[model samples]
Structures are given as structure tokens and as C-alpha cells.
Target: MADTSPSEAGNAPLDQMGLDNFAPYLMNRIMGRYNAALSAEMAALGLTTPQMRSLAVLSVTDGILIRELAVYAVVQQSTLSRALDALVRDGLVRRETDATDSRATRVYLT
Candidate 1:
């Protein structure tokens, strides 16, 4: 006969567990669905998820540094840079170098 001990039951497969026990899993799934819906709407405006996020942040904090935008937008600098390039091309955003720090670039919504 197989050993069906109480202790062994604790190691049961995740499929047997309640999903409500995993907050991160639930949150991720919720966000995924939300982004999917929002992405479709934004796509009609010729904007991507990243671009929408950047604009949302810029709306509140215009002339924010590129590095700051990355953090606020929850996007990597390299990825945000590409999105910003497209936004600039579309005349939706303006990119300017910081006067005091030439190495830093700031972005504003146009």
C-alpha cells in the first residue's frame, strides 16, 4: 500500500491548491487581462502600451528626466528610449537635453 501521511499532503501539487492563496498570481492574471483590453484600444490610436505609459507619466510630470521616466513608466531605459523616439517622430512628445546636465535628457508631452 502507498504511504499517505499528513506531512506528505503538504507537498501536494499547486493544481490542488486554492488560487486565492497566491496573490501575485491573481494580480498578474488581472493585470494581463487589463493590459490586453487597454492595448487594443490604444492600438487604434497608433500608440503602444509602453508609449501610453510614458505619456501617462509625462502628463503628470512634464519635463521629467529620461531615467526618471523609466522608473515611473516601469520600463527599461533602452525600451523607453525606442518608444520615446517613435513618440517624438509622431509629434506627441518632445525630448530635450538638460541644461545643467547635458548627459541627462528630459521629456515633455507635446
Candidate 2:
């Protein structure tokens, strides 16, 4: 049997709590494995996580606004900007001024 009791500080030690019982820890572990596997595939394709994420979103919603793409890709705008720059340089994607909004830019897979 496992001791599930909290310590004097009113927080149970991680070992006692068991890693499998922690949702956040479990989620992080799962994501770590997923990222590791994805990293290899991305490297083979010459794509980083942000770049791949951007392409994924664009595949589903082509010509999406840059701001919206950042949200959908779950990356910071600055990171997405750099990734998009590389993608554009590599000829994987293209950026264009939004037809409806001159100030906004849209991303599309090429």
C-alpha cells in the first residue's frame, strides 16, 4: 500500500503522491514524448515545431491571418514570425497582405 498522506508543510511529496496520479506531470510527460517523436520527423522534413504547427493550421485553413495563425499554431507571434520567415525563404509557404485589411497579413501554403 502507498502512503498518500501530506507532509508537515501540508503538501504531499511527489513520490508519495505518485507521478501517475498527477495530471499535470502526466500531461507534461506525454507531451515530452510526443515532442521527441515529432522532433525527429520534423528534422527529417527540415521543419521546426513552430513551422510545422503553422503549416498544419494553414493546411486546414489556408490563407489564415497571421494573428489568427499564431493562436491556432499555439505559438507566440514573434516565434511564428521567425518560423514564417524561414518557411517563406524555403518556399514552403507564402505571405500576402489581406485583401480585406491592408494592415493584416495572411499565410498560405505553397
Candidate 3:
């Protein structure tokens, strides 16, 4: 096996690498704080992160397909499916079979 020590690899150790210098770390920290601040407001409205994300995406792009919505909302297809079910049940959104492709479903805000 090849040695991957920091001196041999010419890479700084994680502790030596400042957190701000890491884009993903910074983004995760920011999002964590944002979510913590928003959680209570969302809960009061009976929404989870995935549900809120779905509504945010649907607001701008109504009638988007379920698979596409999952990508745009950054949620898993199965998780979005459950969220959509709740949204539909609460009358916040509706789903209709796609006219062109009967197998596909499109979502719309109500």
C-alpha cells in the first residue's frame, strides 16, 4: 500500500485547513443555522424541510413532474412522494396524471 501521510501526500491535515477555506463545510454550517432558525416557523405551518422545499420549487415551477421536482427540491424521490401525499391531503397542492404520458404525474399548487 502507498503511504498517504500528509508530508508524502503534500496535503494539509483537516485540522490545519481552516473551516472557512472548505466550501462544503461552510455551506453545511450556513444551512444548519438557517434550518434551525426556520424550523419553528415551518413547524407552525405544518411543514417539514422536504415539504417546504417542494412548495418553494412548485411556487416558481408549477406542474413540474414528480421526478424533476425531486431533483429541483434536492429531496429523494421516496421522501418527496410522502411529502406530496401530505401536501395533497392538506389541499396545498394537487397532482394530476400527465396528459401526454399517462404514467407520469405533475404537481400544481392550489
Candidate 4:
């Protein structure tokens, strides 16, 4: 009555596959371990992984539009917004309206 082929089933069930066999899961696990190791150092500086990434990118690029920053930082605008908000509040980063484009907002490290 219903298709039950491998293609129709989409991804294999998690229980059927070893955790190491899933790329997404493996990447997440790797990042989780790295983040865990970095947690103490990050906490001392009052930064999360995303916030650290945002700052790191800004530090290299200096001034970049929020959209561009999101690209380099590998985060969605909505997600980057939270990190930017904290950085702005902490005085670690600054935001200025773009002179040529009213709708574009540029961010820079302080």
C-alpha cells in the first residue's frame, strides 16, 4: 500500500546507524567537544562560541555589513543578531549606519 524502499524512507533511522557514520552528527560532536574545551576560556572573556566567531571575523575584517558578517561568521541573521546585541552591549563591538545605504548596518570591533 505504501512505498518502503530505501529512497522513500529518506535517511536511515538513527538507531540503525552508528553515530560516527552520520556526518552531521559527527561534526556536531566535534564542535561540541571543541566548544566544551573552550568554554572556560570563553567564559573568562564573557563570550559564547557564536559571539567569539563574530568577534573573530570582525577583528580580521574590521568593518563589515551585518549581512556580510553573518556570511563570514556562518550564522543566520536572526542568530547573529543576538551575538551582536551582546557584543554591542559589552562594548566589544560597534554598529554604525552605512552612509551609502540606509538599510545596511555595518559592524566593527571596538
Candidate 5:
């Protein structure tokens, strides 16, 4: 195989950006385009990116609490609640209390 020449390697600052850089940048570019399309397709279904994320998390995990959703959604509790509210209003999700811990509320995809 041909070797990587000195300058064949990217500039130092770019290399310093490294794998961490590529993953988010590339993922964001792809997701941005995909989200644009998804937004239009799912608009009639009343779903937004945040709402879809919440539903996916609840569906996969199957009964995580609101606090856990906040973590999974990578947002503040208030933000997750607002997202969940829209989803619940749209009939895509339901929240139930944990009998063992009245303070805990688990969310599930309806």
C-alpha cells in the first residue's frame, strides 16, 4: 500500500480536531438534511424532531421515568416536559406513575 506522505497527512490543527470532530460534523450534516425531509413527511402526523426522539427513547427503553428522559434527550427537565407534552397531546406517548415511588413518572410510547 502507498504510504501517507508528510503533507499527505492533514494539517496539524485539522488532525487535532480528529475523530471527535468528524463524527459530530458529519452526523450533523446528514441529520440536518434528513431532518428537513422528515419534518415535511411527518408534519401531518404532528411530530417534531424532539417529539420523535422522545418517542424512540420511550419505545426502545419501554418505561423510563421523566428524569431519565431528560437525560436521554440531552435536555433540561423543563425542555423534555415540553416535548413530552406535545407528544402526549398528539397521542403518541403516555406517562404513568411508578407505584413504588409516587414521585417517579414513567413515560411510554402509546
Candidate 6:
């Protein structure tokens, strides 16, 4: 008989552990493959996933606040700041302080 134990099957069946049987483990492998292809394509464009996402968000919202852009870009605030700074230096993006709130910065595409 074929062994069904973890040592032989690699991972225990979710049903055995009483967890949801959605087969998330296999889905993770599929996602990894997809990400690898996506990263390669983005790299050819001189952009990382985060940078690409930022550009996509900017295209949709021509002038969005920096904080809101960060959320849409799906990057950490500090990481987004560095990415935005690079985009600004490259003449692809610019920042402007809100007239009503000097502390807040709005980002615009160039």
C-alpha cells in the first residue's frame, strides 16, 4: 500500500488536521510560479513589483495623496516613500504640499 504519512506525502492532509480543506498549500506553489514570471517581466521594464504598482495607481488617480498612494501601491509607508522619491528624481512623479494642510503631500504624475 502507498504510504499516506507526512514523511511520504510531504504534507499532512488538511482533512486529517480538521482544517479547512481548500488546499491552500498547493495554491501557494501556483502563486510562486506566477510571481516569478511577473517579476521577470517587471525587471525588464526597470521596475520592481512595488514600483509597477505605484505607477498603476498613479495612472488611475492622476493626483492622489502620498498616504493614499501607499495603500494603493501595497507597499510599506517607508518603502513607498523611497520609491516615490526615486520616481520624482526620474521626472516621472512630483509632490506638492496641500495648501490647506502644509504637512500633507499630494503626489502627481509627470
Clashes of each: 0, 0, 0, 0, 0, 0
Weakest 10 consecutive residues, lDDT, candidate 3?
Answer: 7-16
**How would you encode candidate 3's per-residue C-alpha lDDT over 11-102 as one tens digit per residue?**
66767777877778999999999988787789998899899999999999999999999999999999999999999999999999999999
Badly placed stretches (over 4 Å) of model 1 are: 1-17
TM-score of each: 0.82, 0.81, 0.84, 0.69, 0.67, 0.71
Sort by TM-score, top down from the best: 3, 1, 2, 6, 4, 5
Off by over 4 Å in 3: 1-13
Model 4: how far residue 32 lies from native, Å: 1.9
- What do the candidate models score in CA lDDT, each in turn? 0.92, 0.93, 0.93, 0.88, 0.79, 0.82
1-110: candidate 2 lDDT, tens digit per residue: 67665775568788877888888999999999998999899999999999999998999999999999999999999999999999999999999999989999999899
Better of 4 and 6 by TM-score: 6
Q: Give the better candidate number (1 or 4) by lDDT.
A: 1
Model 5 lDDT, full chain set: 0.79
lDDT of model 2 at position 84: 100
Which candidate would rank higher by lDDT, 3 or 4? 3
Better of 2 and 6 by lDDT: 2
Model 6 lDDT vs. the true structure? 0.82
Residue 109 accuracy (lDDT) in model 6: 87
lDDT of 3 at 24: 85
RMSD of each: 5.0, 5.2, 3.4, 4.1, 5.6, 7.5
lDDT of 2: 0.93
Residue 59, candidate 1: alpha-carbon lDDT: 91
Better of 1 and 3 by lDDT: 3
For model 6, how does the per-residue alpha-carbon lDDT over 18-100 read when each residue is reduced to its tens digit? 34544676687787898789889989987777777888999999788889998887789899988888888888889999788
lDDT of 5 by residue, 1-110 (tens): 98875456753454766666666778988989988998787777777667777776877897898998878866688878888888888787889999799999998887
TM-score of model 6 (CA atoms): 0.71
Better of 4 and 5 by lDDT: 4
